[model samples]
Target: MKMMERLETFLVLAECGSFTEAAKKLFCSQPTISHHIQKLEEQFGAPLFIRTGRTAQLTRQGEIFLDYAKQIEQTMLQAGSAIESSMKTESSIVSVYVSQYFANYYFDEILPTLHASDPPYRLEINAYCYEALKQALVDRKTDWAIMPYYPDDDFIRSDFAVHALFEDEFMLVLPPEHVLMNRKTIYARDLQGATVLLPRSPFLIRSLQKEMDRHGLRVQYLQMSNFEVIKQAVKSGLGAAFLPYRAIRKELEAEELTAKRLPFFGYLRQNGVLVRKGARFTAEEQAFFERLRPHFDEGAPAGRSAFS
Candidate 1:
């Protein structure tokens, strides 16, 4: 049997923990599955599994082998994808991880342009929270990530390149009946002694706290992770919270929520594109980025600004 076939059989056996189950999964007879594993063990000169009466467990050697098998499988898959992409005039698959806010607001506008190009592309958007977004990039599960402004991290700076796409300011969201709701512009000091609902992520919360500290203001609030939940809490008069202006635009326009611009918040969140550093872009991705450049430029006039 071929090495690839043996590797596939081994992976299935590891996952299913039985020859019968692996056979069923691979749609082959039990003997065929057993034969593949037997050959693999013979070639490696090590027992791969600890056979009990009816169950099997991976030996220490098996565990190490499994890791390499998985890596090989992934590399093979990536190689196959690369070849398939080359055969086509343009590849359709472009996977991306984008924040919920960006997916909801800007993806549609960008899609039309991508679709209009030759060798049409299909965009798969994975909407993830902060941590998941970073993981997707690290795992190479996504071709790109769209995220809010973040502090420069060594990993991201060294392994990924970021392009600024747009920017929006943070605003205080308050219930219409709240005391601060009537203010044309909200100051951080107004939050003192108030139950402010803030996002629970340490990175985001810390950034907000740092900004408040610089201005000698303190906001005391219960932290919640879900943005929608925070909005509901604010609307129900539970507390005030901060959100990007774009995120609350509809609510502000409909008067469902009142948003006061925070002048004291010196920095605006730059929504940007992130691509893996030193990774060669497929032709389609290169073309897609080229087309996207103009739209990113056009967004600057609205509020997009560079951070020093």
Candidate 2:
């Protein structure tokens, strides 16, 4: 098989996780998919996948190969699109990366405006978290990344520029019937010896520790990643938790939960727009930034406005 065809087969197999599924995706027989993978394995002189029952997992070499394959695929597609754009005199593709939080909150408002604009162009958006989004920008895999403000890092800050979009504060959340609900403000001392449900991220854990240390208090922590699970845990009276104001606004308004002001500690997080420095932007991306500029300028007047 040709290199491009084999590469396509490998990518489909990786996505679907089985030869049968890959065959279906590629509109070919399972045997053909198997033959392509077998040829690839022979050329590389190593096993690419570890088969267990009906499932297949990528081996170490396969994992490394997959990354390179994706980069090559993206480059080839970009080159082809560049040729097509030159031939037809059309605008180029605009690729952007956004975190899951921002995508859920703001994508709907942004998409419609782009769709109605002149000189129609392609828009590619990748929803990724911290490290993946950072790498995408550093590798020039994405043109822009919409995410929370990360402290300046060598790979990211040197090559990209970030614009502050908006800031939001973390809120002290409690069940409606919790004792803290009656209080106008809650202090770190108020949470001493209490169980605090928090996300299992180093940044958050470290920040919490610093806050607790400042007040000379200690608390038990229930660490988990799923937001819904954390909410449920808190609602069951298992513990108190802190979340971004935007995340719990509906619950607070519905009176399902109550929030109290934090004392002395700001507990703020900023969201920013990250773009590759000196990277050329297509018309669509330029128009997106133009539309986005006003919202950031408006800032957090109420101290808890939703970017959505």
Candidate 3:
């Protein structure tokens, strides 16, 4: 018999305190129990039990082995339980995390199609700010992520794979009737001293600042953290802001905001699907990601074409 099986027999016999009783409990004959115990004692090079008239008593060595045997059994049980839990979680649900921007602009656009396809697994999708989403991806707390910003860290690059889905431009957004609407082309210097709405997150604000510095543009800032709020502010003629054109496509179509092309801001943000390197995804999970990629149009708006 295997060492583990022998150890299990030893544990049960030790608990029963009688060879005959142990055999009865294990649904085996008394001689079979004797054989297993004898094999165990021989392997350990000591007597694990002492026979007294009708009862079996543990020896000193047996007590020490008993502790180790119990520990091994408990470890095996816990390992089994953890693996089972992991399997259930993976098979039943697909966990995906998205940046706040992607969730806001693309989630509703994609949901109806996803539902119509009738996927096998349930989806638990969460939207987080850029910083929070980055942290979650680094910690492996999410199975998949869709975000615009990719961390420039070597560890992240080596440990994760990023599939570029689509590109969206960060254009100069202004109220439809703003003075700049008449300008055929907008340059960074054109907005000098203009009040520009800024995202509130420190990480995002810092990134925007670096881009502005690179282009040699200086503007007064009005901080509004939420994207929806920023769009509202622009519609209300609060200020001109730099925002992803796709994010404000509907508003632009309705003439609520006038979007101007800024050559310097082009190709600044590429939204992509991010996943851990060397992960074994379930069939359902893989199917979901495959279906999702086609919804984003490259170098254009979302929901247009497959990744090309």
Task: Report the number of the highest-lDDT candidate.
Answer: 3
Which 10 consecutive residues of model 1 have the lowest summed lDDT?
A: 299-308
Superposed Cα deviation of residue 81, candidate 1 (Å):
17
Q: Which regions of candidate 1 fall more than 4 Å away from where they truly are?
A: 1-90, 116-119, 297-308
Native-to-model Cα distance after best TM-score fit, residue 264 in candidate 1, in Å? 1.9
The global C-alpha lDDT for each of the candidates, from Candidate 1 onward, is 0.76, 0.74, 0.79
Q: What is the C-alpha RMSD of each candidate to the true structure, in Å?
A: 16.1, 19.8, 9.1
Tens-place lDDT digits, model 3, residues 1-308 = 48877888899999999988988898988888889999998888999999986589999999999999999999999999999999987776767788888888888878778877764447788899877887897787875678865455555578777778777667788898988889887777788888889888775666677788788788888899777899999899888887887789999888888888777765366678776766666766667777787786653244432122
Model 1 TM-score on a 0 to 1 scale: 0.63
Give one digit per residue, the lDDT tens place, for model 1 in 1-308: 38888899999999989888888899999889878989999999999988775466899999999999999999999999989878673355666578877777676788787788785677766898777788788888875677875765556677766777777677778877787767776666677777778886666777777777788776576988777788888888888877887678778888889877678776566677776765666655655566666776533233332210
Between which residue pairs do clashes occur in model 3? none
Model 2: clashing residue pairs?
none
lDDT of 3 at 260: 80
What is the Cα-based TM-score of model 2? 0.61
Best by TM-score: 3
lDDT of 3: 0.79
